[model samples]
Target: MSGILRFLLSGLAVLLTSYLLNGVHVRDYWYALLVAAVLSLANVIVRPVLIFFTIPITFITLGLFLLVINALIILLVDFLVPGFNVDGFWWALAFSLILAIFNSLFDDITGEKAKRNQD
Candidate 1:
């Protein structure tokens, strides 16, 4: 199903992103899968709270502060996940940006067919 495909693609993105960044390390494919799942959960649960609390700064920065929130989420995941590691805040920021790009690319690849079917 598309849900399973999306999950797998997300894991692939994580693995690929880790490979692309020197400061990011993922132990293996399985860990990448775990990282993807945790990252999704963090985005769902933690991200909203962060956005709510930092609304003023987020607004002041013209939405750039969301990148900081993304980095913080990566750092939090690095703390919670054993096999996935981000070297530091800078590394976390780089990892997050790269991951977002990968995720978007993968999503477009997978989503195009679904959109065609829907149309």
Candidate 2:
């Protein structure tokens, strides 16, 4: 299904991000998959709530606060998942940015955009 494909793509993105960033560590592809799943779930459940509560600050910062929220989610996943580690706050922030970039690129390369048109 498309969802499964998206999940795998996200895992690949995580692996790619870890490879490019010095302070981010993913033990293996399995851990990358797990990290991707957790991040997806957190984005669905936790991120919206955090964003809702931080709307004022998010607006005040001209949307920059979302980056901090993304870093916090990365740190949360680091705590909840084993074998995936982000070195520090700065590294986590960097990791989030890189992961986002990689995920977008992977989605585009894998025909996900074309699939979206059909849906």
The lDDT for every candidate, in the order shown, is 0.92, 0.94
lDDT score of residue 39 within candidate 1: 95
lDDT of 1 by residue, 14-73 (tens): 999999988999999999999999999999999999999999999999999999999999
Which parts of model 1 are misplaced by more than 4 Å?
Answer: 112-119
TM values, all candidates: 0.93, 0.93
Predicted candidate 2 versus true structure: per-residue lDDT over 1-119, tens digit per residue: 87898899899889999999999999999999999999989999999999999999999999999999999999999999998999999999999998988887877888888888898
Using lDDT as the measure, the top candidate is 2
lDDT of 1: 0.92
lDDT of residue 82 for candidate 2: 96
Q: In model 1, which residue pairs have backbone atoms overlapping below 3 Å?
A: none
